[model samples]
Target: MRRHLDRIDQLILAELRHNARIPVAALGDRVNLSRNAVRQRIERLERDEYIQGYTIVEHTAEARANVTANLFVYRTDRMRGGEVIAALKSVPEVVICDVMSGEFDLFVRLEAPSVDRVRAVWQQISMMTGVRDITTTVTLSTVIDRT
Candidate 1:
């Protein structure tokens, strides 16, 4: 069963999302709760699997200047394309590859140093067995990234 979150829970989640390492007392100050109350709520949230994990986002100049692209991939055999996925995993530029439904079998997101590098990675993916077709789209800008 799914759990329904109230306003306080939502606010706590928002603050934690912005900074997972935020102190319980600071979080309580923001949410109008006591420190122990906030700690208990956080523990419950984790126990309920609402707070799965935390991670850091890179803000380096090299990371910001990288070329980003999305690839809509059509596989010859969607059910048995583990080899293709493994090959993609070997490519350092491949950031995310998600299995999809509907017309596309896979959606791949990659970041590389330059457009030339993007092209090279694209060619490498296109030549992989079981990859029937790939449609690549380069990102011009990211206007609103809450993450």
Candidate 2:
């Protein structure tokens, strides 16, 4: 029988999405699974095509030349608004999302091939149910990036 994804499985996928090169043992620790168990689940996910492959984010000047923006997301129900986060996961361009303490609830960073695409993504986020408001700012240039 084909296996269905559980919350643990989803967590594993989320961790992998953030850092594709994360060690299986470390990933297991984050998801509260054993190393072997995590390995097996990863293999199953790959075999089942849930995980096709892993790739690195380019940091070259040419790559950085693409459109990048920050989205200050204000949530209506901050404590109960997990739906907004789940929705953000569906957007491939959203590279980073930080849950914050005051004012805005989420700080989202997105990168796209063009300004139009970034605008479209911004529009999409603004329309999600729990999202109260979104203030967007496009990056002019990267002065320093350690990573």
Superposed model 1: Cα runs more than 4 Å off? 1-56
Point out where model 2 deviates above 4 Å: 1-61
Cα lDDT of model 1 by residue, 67-132, tens digit:
999999999998998888999999999999999999999999999999999999999999999999
**Candidate 2 colliding pairs:** none
The numbered model that scores best in lDDT is 2
Q: Write the per-residue lDDT of candidate 2 for residues 53-108, one digit (tens) a residue.
A: 77676868788777999999999999999999999999999999999998899999
Whole-model Cα lDDT of every candidate shown, in order: 0.92, 0.94
